[model samples]
Every structure is written in C-alpha cells, then in structure tokens.
Target: MLQLPHQSLQVAAVPAQRTAAREDQDGPWHTEAVCRRDEAGLFFAPSKEPTAARLSREDAAKRVCARCPVMVECREHALLQPEPYGVWGGLTAAERRVVLARRRRREMELKKSASAA
Candidate 1:
C-alpha cells in the first residue's frame, strides 16, 4: 500500500514504522525510540561487570534494541558519536569497534584501489 509523505505505517502492536520519520527516511528518528521507555540500566554495562555477566547483559540489551523503533537511528548515533559505553543497535561498544575497524579497513582498500586505478 502507498503511504502519503510524512505518514508512518506500523504493522503490529510494536511500532515498527515502515520507514523513518524524516523526509528522506534518515532524519533524527531516535526521538521516537522505544528504548526511551525502558530503564537506562538496560542499555549500559556496569563498571565492574564480569565477562559472563557482561555478555548476558549485552544479549538482553540487544533483544530490546532488536525491537526498537529507532534501532537504525540509535545505531547511527552511537557510531557517529563513537559512544564509549553501552549497547546500541544490538551491538555492544566492543562490537561496534569491530565494525568501525572493518569499515576503516574497507575504506583504505577502496582508496588504495582508486589511487592504483
């Protein structure tokens, strides 16, 4: 079905909007995140959390993020700000570091290829 501009469509009880609220579907949609209703502790790791506890905590947090309405925007915001803590977009900070590293490597490879070409 065709939705008019600026209109949001949800398929279920959860607010899984078909697209972002922005005109281009990429605006600051984090404002509508379901996480806002959850406790802040759910999204952050404890300073002295053990490895096993951290893993379990992160997994639980990821589940919440998976169903979040603004998962994409939250992830983007975390990466752009280089958030030093917490679980965002179903990824712990460490996981996001790995993604960023991979992205950097890919960018370098692309640059090298372009220069060589």
Candidate 2:
C-alpha cells in the first residue's frame, strides 16, 4: 500500500502481489521487502547515468530500505551472494565491499589471536 515517489499506486500494487507470490514459492522475507513494491530503476543505475542522478536515486532507494522489515535478511543475502550491482540492504556495491573487507580483516585478526594463544 506504500507508494513511492514518481510511482503510481497501481504500479506499486502489481509488484507487491508478484513479490507475495514469489514469497509463497521462494521465501517470506522477500515479500516483506519495501523495494519489492518499488521500481527497480530506483535502486539500479542505468549505463552512463550522471553522477548526481545516480547518487539521488541511490539515496531514494536507501530510504525505502530504511523502512524494510526484512532489511537484515536482505543485507545478509546480498553479502553472501555478493550481488554485483544495485543498492542492496541500504548499501551501495562499494559499501558492501568495504563491509566485506572489514569483516575479513576482523576474522583474520581473530584467527591470529587464537593461533597465538
């Protein structure tokens, strides 16, 4: 029932239903994603999109993600799958890479401490 900026109510409803059906078959978390009812373009950049436009679009997409019930699940999925594009779980692809790197560093530190102990 939530309508996104520049998106019609009718447009929002269709994807919501599709996401619901997908959830029935795929899983429940996806059905609850706020992005499911929104346009994919809001989250993804087109080829050669302007820098300002891409940043604006990504910020809007992150706003939707901010309210998602399944945000943690979605973020974890993105992290694990290493999705190569778009804004996932409130993070840009670059942001996800940073997170992954930090995690790897922390893990290595822990391993080193364990081995030393």
Q: Which 10-residue window of candidate 1 scores lowest in summed lDDT?
A: 8-17
Distance from true location, Cα of 62 in model 1, Å? 0.3
Question: Mind sharing the TM-score for model 2?
Answer: 0.77
Question: Highest TM-score: which candidate?
Answer: 2
Local distance difference test scores for all models: 0.66, 0.70
Model 2, 1-117: lDDT tens digits are: 224466422211111122222244456777678876745557666667667666777888898889888888778777887776788889998999999999999999999999999
Give the distance in Å from residue 50's predicted Cα in candidate 1 to where it truly belongs: 2.2
Mind sharing the TM-score for model 1? 0.73
How does model 2 fare in lDDT? 0.70
For model 1, residues 7-66, the per-residue Cα lDDT tens digits are: 322211222323333433555576667767753455665456567666665666788888
